[model samples]
Target: MNSEFSYRLLPGLLPYYAFRVCTKFLQSQDLILPGVIIGFLANGFNIFSNWLFIFQFELGVNGAPWATSLTRAIQFIFMILYLLWRKDSLADTWPSFSLRKLSYNVVKPFLTLAFSGMFSFAAEAWSFEVTTILAGLLGTIALDSHTITLNIATFIYLSFPFAVGIATSIKVGQLIGEGKAADARRSAIVAYGVNFAVQITLIAIVWPCSRLIASLFSKDEEIVDLVASLIPLSCIFMLGDAVQANTGGALRGLGRQKLVLLLNILGFWLLAVPFGAVLAFATNIGVRGLWWGFTVGLYSAAFIGILFLVFRVNWEKEAFKAQRRIAQTSQ
Candidate 1:
């Protein structure tokens, strides 16, 4: 499974990158619904392919990534087709390519921001990936619980808070572009209102029906028991995640990815992963140790993040800087 998971992940990387690029471009254009619909189609196909390859074909572990790769490829193709269909609408942004446009001065700032944003996301993501690896080391039962809980948390993050974050970033960017820093600040507040709304809704679903939720993922009684035990921790983890996502989104709108990268490193690496590893390996607390460690780090980071947004950030100044940068770039 190790070798298979490793190599299998490779085939999907390029397609996933392509899909992400297309989706982001669409998002920036305020064409999010297209990407969402395409994503749904791809995921729907992925589920069917997983069933076909894993169950009907009886290929087991080997079949899963193949299904994923195919789905990713389909998604990229669909996104490309969507762009082609909208060629006329995108023409202004897709001016003819020119060799003289490829200067370092033009690309450097973009690359810096892009890379900072990339690493900011990767830092948090990799911590969970690390947890998954550690779970594998603990044994099959532990891995099962970790996998199910992680998936549930990820699903909720992506479906709700993450979406709110993206919308907040877009709204803030629009407000800043219009030189309305006060409006952007208000938009951020509105986003938090939405974020907590969804979080409450999520807690309602995950708390009382935890065992039922676990059973949805796995039928084995032992796995169900273990996953249910992790749900309370996951609920707490989601709150921190929601706050982090909200703060992170606002910073991105301010073009402050460097600060975001710093925070993620301080939280996930300096705090979460190391502490979780110690709790998991140095103690008898087992998988829950890692879970608690992550919760602590996330909550700590989120607290600091919210504080920074409230006290440190100067929205009017950020908007002025952004307008200056835009004016300079246009020249």
Candidate 2:
């Protein structure tokens, strides 16, 4: 009952959620540096709030949600104040809302994009969560090693290709808005090429230093060995992961969002999870089998995405679609 009540505090975070959407919209409009700065500050505030509530206040486990809600509320207020100070059109226009304008211009497209994008994100995330659950079922050592390895991989992902992918999405969309279909395609190609080169270099660096990296996270020899063994598989997984991530971003910019969402559903849910389950339980390979399944799904998604970009996409048509969408919403 206490936990449920604590969880109820999540509703207080709606403002932060709105703020994030606003930030992303700004970033999509090419205001990248401001958005990045604000996001960094917000994250720092969240961390500080967590430390204050959990350590200084001695609030225990429930401190986490309180810290999150408080930090979000503060961040939301900060964003609103900044917008007001700038006399931003978004703030100025908020009071002039009308049902007819919203229905035709915002709500229709918003719902269509939101549902598809939400499912795509959820499908990929849930597959990894399920993989974690399966790892826990393997044993304590397996779960610990898996957790540490996953953390390292996630850190690397967020550091480079993910950032590049987001920038690529925004840039592509901007180019499309200008009706430069060829330039948009070129941008995507360059983004994908750069991501590939960077990922390959990192893989080479990681392969030689796998044991050294694993040692940083664990003092246990068995855990270190397990993590080291997983690094090679992680390299393969990272390559596919980076490719699919970049491609998915490009697809979003091209306005083929429904297709992107479908691909994620097919790749992660229909393919990765069941295959990983079979390999983990039916074979003697254990936890590594789960990661192997992950590699397969990512590779499949990347291949399909790349193929679509190369052979199937009509850049001219996509540019026009982007133009129409932008024009509609701006009104």
Best by lDDT: 1
Model 2 lDDT-worst window of ten: 86-95
Error of model 1, residue 285, in angstroms: 2.9
**Could you tell me every candidate's TM-score relative to the true structure?**
0.89, 0.90
lDDT of 1 by residue, 76-137 (tens): 99988988999999987754566555666657778999999999999989989999999889
Give all candidates' CA lDDT scores.
0.88, 0.84
TM-score (C-alpha, index-matched) for candidate 2: 0.90
lDDT of 2 by residue, 191-275 (tens): 9999999999999999889999999999999999999999889888998888988998998887667888989987888788888
Candidate 1 stretches with Cα past 4 Å from truth are 5-12, 48-61, 136-139, 218-222, 281-284
Give the C-alpha miss distance for residue 199 in model 1, angstroms.
1.0
Whole-model lDDT, model 1: 0.88
- Alpha-carbon deviation at 213 in model 2, angstroms: 2.6
